[model samples]
Target: MQSITLKKPAPFEKYNQPVGDRYIDVLDGVRAVLVLLVGAFHIWQQSWLTPHFTLFGQRYSLDFLLRSGYIWVDGLILLSGFLLYLPYARAEMGKMPPVGPFLLKRFLRIWPSYALNVILFFFLAVEKYNGNGAYMAKDLVTHLTFTHTFFYDTYYGSPINGGLWTVGVEWWFYLLFPLLGRCYKKKPMLTALGMMTCAFVFRAYVSTLTDTRMWFNQLPAFLDVYALGFIGADAFVALRGKLLQSGKKEKRLFSLICLLCVILLVYIAKAQASSSGQEGIRLGQMAHRFPLALCLLVLMISACFASAGVRFVLGNRVMRFLSAISFQFYMYHQVLCVQIRERRLIPSVSETPNRDSEWPWQPVFTLCSFLLPILLGAILTYGFEKPIIRYFEKMRSRKKK
Candidate 1:
């Protein structure tokens, strides 16, 4: 008897509501885990032991580990593409009209805490500026206008948290989201590949240049990361339906391949880190990481697309809580670290001179400043983010009514 192979079915129709199973929510938990880990890394930098290589190697302070956590930033960029755009992409693919207040809702979601963070930074920080007053003004204006990363260099000095650099990048993404949506609707696969290629080329160019000065000041190039997020969003919407429709054998096989890819990518990244030669570092930063980030984004969406059991694990209540709190945790950490440093609450027992004390505290300040910020960030999220979101939503509802 001849074996009959059934033709594959078409993908599932998209949903109007941005619902993913418990798996996606579990991915949210993963996001929160990443956020908290990065936060802890930052706080840990206050003071930690320095590992010496050849006595000339830079002291391996707690901050060194924190700095190494830069990978988390890449994780975040990927997650932004996966989570933020998932709902809309699904709705759009289904031909449902976008929620009436989509842009307004997003604006309110981001603006409140962002605005508050800036104000808080200005009052509590920013006074340490040694640059010209004009530079300071330009910085303040550009940051407020969300044009600093693309149009100006505002984060050069002062107590402006280093973490805020991603904010400027994110704002540019917000401005271009509609265009991204249109592009996804038109030819998502092409758009995804194009953006990924562009990101690779930009990073490659930067790596080759001895002094990446131009790349440092360049806006269009840096926009690639955020654009990658948009592409990831499109992929999530496109692949999810296909994955769901695949046979059990195919699904299992695909899952195995994806898992292998992720493991291989991570191993490559670890190898790149270990190489430590100038070339290795550059390649690790510019070349290996983008693929790693893309793979991470894929894995996240895969969890959502996986079997019901997988989805249940991903969307569990604990995961949802973590996802909800992740953003707040990310933003609140730097301020907390700074405040602790200022108060000398994290004591530096090291005898190194002030100039030489790269790690301020001897024992690692990561754990010391966490409790306060975690507490405060949770409060602020409730007070600021929730209220602003609710206010805008209420207004939108009233208008519709």
Candidate 2:
């Protein structure tokens, strides 16, 4: 197996260090923010709370923002692309990341807790299973192998959980990233353009289809987002020298630029969400991902080079801690939120359910949705995932000896 030995860089020597040698704490913050958006969006679906304020004699509500949370998922995908390619972003880098170690680490990162959690969910809540035994078996098989996104039944009618479709997409990205990374390393612009063009073609094909949902939800459809991420990583590495050398004036400019990029992203999202029908919605999502990814990258790179205040707001200990367990949190939250709705945990005067009404039970449901998954995610992160990874590392060490 490929060893876990990374090129060590001194924390203080930012300029002299290898681009991928050190941890980027801000990325954790980014992931944390995206995860929170996703969680809140899901919670909002249940609570039906349209958080709004009166500004300049106009009422602005976040209902549109919550409705467009899929864009945030695109951001997360791009961030993953940015992160994985950072090691290769440096032009002087010679050795490639080993395939075995990369796959091994990715596997350990995902499957251990995933398997454990899903298995528990399956057995403990067998009563909640949606279909017959055969159907449920098929779903379980597909989910465990990370191939559930390919099918209609499992992807749409997940008997156990549908929240993991993104995980399936991410696993495919992981498998393809090494090849894509090598191509990007050899020819950055060409490789990126090729990936984007391929994704564009795929989206175009999906748009032509009658039921675009199944086709649009696959990994191939999001190649442009990943390509943008790779480009972002490359650009950030190229710009780090200038960033580190920036004065107060430059930092202030960067902060302003980042803020503007965020505003543009909001505008684009609102405009894209204007489509009426289901088909139009799918088309708009496919059509608008590129621009959204572009905006996200701009914000990402700018935030990295922005003022200390911007960096602090975006990159702090709390954010990093949340991010550390973000995957588990993201994975478990849907079930937990559904449970909150299903079990009627929060008090409601509605005839049927809380989601059926507009009264703000946001506080109770939001806390349960965010806090419970976080607690579970933290426990799984420390209790299961870390131990599995450390065990593999220890085994690798002994083998080397």
Candidate 3:
């Protein structure tokens, strides 16, 4: 089959909007890092690493490092909100495509790859279910409809595919974007504050009703994170020129702030792991969600105005390639990694049979887990996603004509 190619918009295209920071290559680098972090966390969790290991004669556990990987999911959420909101913000200014086409474009962009995974997982579940009729039926219905995150019983149940709960959350956000766009267009700061307030209040109320950690899977719990992105979009539009022309001192300041955000995030993750233990990590994550989101927002915005050294690192060719396939990588990595670990397809690092430290082999497994997803993601992107997206764009264009 021929590959699909999307035509670039002409310089003076009628619908083109000079949205702030049209494309920051560094953000792709950030995405590459986030996906890898989440990938590494999954590998570490599934590996045969012992609960405790002695490093440099000191006993330590890397559980916190792995647990902290969950925060990157919020990072992904923030990025999505930022990117999606930009076009909507532009549309609000009457410079971009209409809301209907934008929504359709979003649906077409996400659904093909996501639907394929859902189908693949559905069949996998069918094989695994055997004679468990009722549960299988329920899982199929919930997964198909993306309603798996709404109910405690269903959310906590055996998910057809691991790491897909976010799909439901993200999909709902897409549905509500038009409403959120209206709020943002009228008063960006109030919209952001309202979203944050609603998220905190909803989370607090839900905590009283149930102790389910899956509460984070709901869209309400992530409203603040999404809102932060919306705010960032508005900021970028208003400040893009100033940000790009920032002087050496300003760039240095942004770098320092980015570093501080990283340090603060690591500190919070470590503190949660140390004080709460593994079980309490979820509650810790909940408690620190706002802080984590804020740190991510700062990092993202800073990356836009980063110095040459930072830009070079983030905009490297390999990082950009990884970022391009990030969606597919994210969608497929957990399932593949878990299967590889469960099957013991490769050796781990630990020389001893105690499964304590699998250094060399652990790295190999991690590399494979990361690469295999990219390979599959590349195929999905080229073979399925792009073609379907192009087809939809053609339909929209023809309608316009």
Q: What is the C-alpha RMSD, rounded to one decimal, of candidate 1? A: 9.0
Question: How many collisions between residues are there in candidate 2?
Answer: 0
Best by lDDT: 2
Residue-by-residue lDDT tens digits, candidate 2, 1-401: 88898889754343222223257656777889988888877877776666789999999888778777666888899999998888788645478877788989999888988888768777756665654788778878888998888888878877466678888899999999889999999888899999999999999999999989898868989899999999888888878865566777877887899989989988977976686788888888888888988988998888777766777776778987899999899988878888788788877777455556535565667678789999999998998899999999999899999
lDDT of each: 0.61, 0.81, 0.76
Alpha carbon deviation, residue 84, candidate 3 (Å): 1.7
- Pairing residues by index, what is the TM-score of model 3? 0.85
Worst 10 residues of 1 by lDDT: 10-19
Better of 1 and 2 by TM-score: 2
Off by over 4 Å in 2: 1-21, 91-93, 128-131, 353-360
* TM agreement with the true structure for every prediction: 0.75, 0.91, 0.85
- lDDT for position 182 in model 2: 92
Off-target runs (Cα >4 Å) in candidate 1 are 1-23, 49-67, 92-100, 130-132, 150-153, 213-262, 275-283, 305-314, 347-364
Ranking by lDDT: 2, 3, 1
At residue 344, what lDDT does model 1 achieve?
66
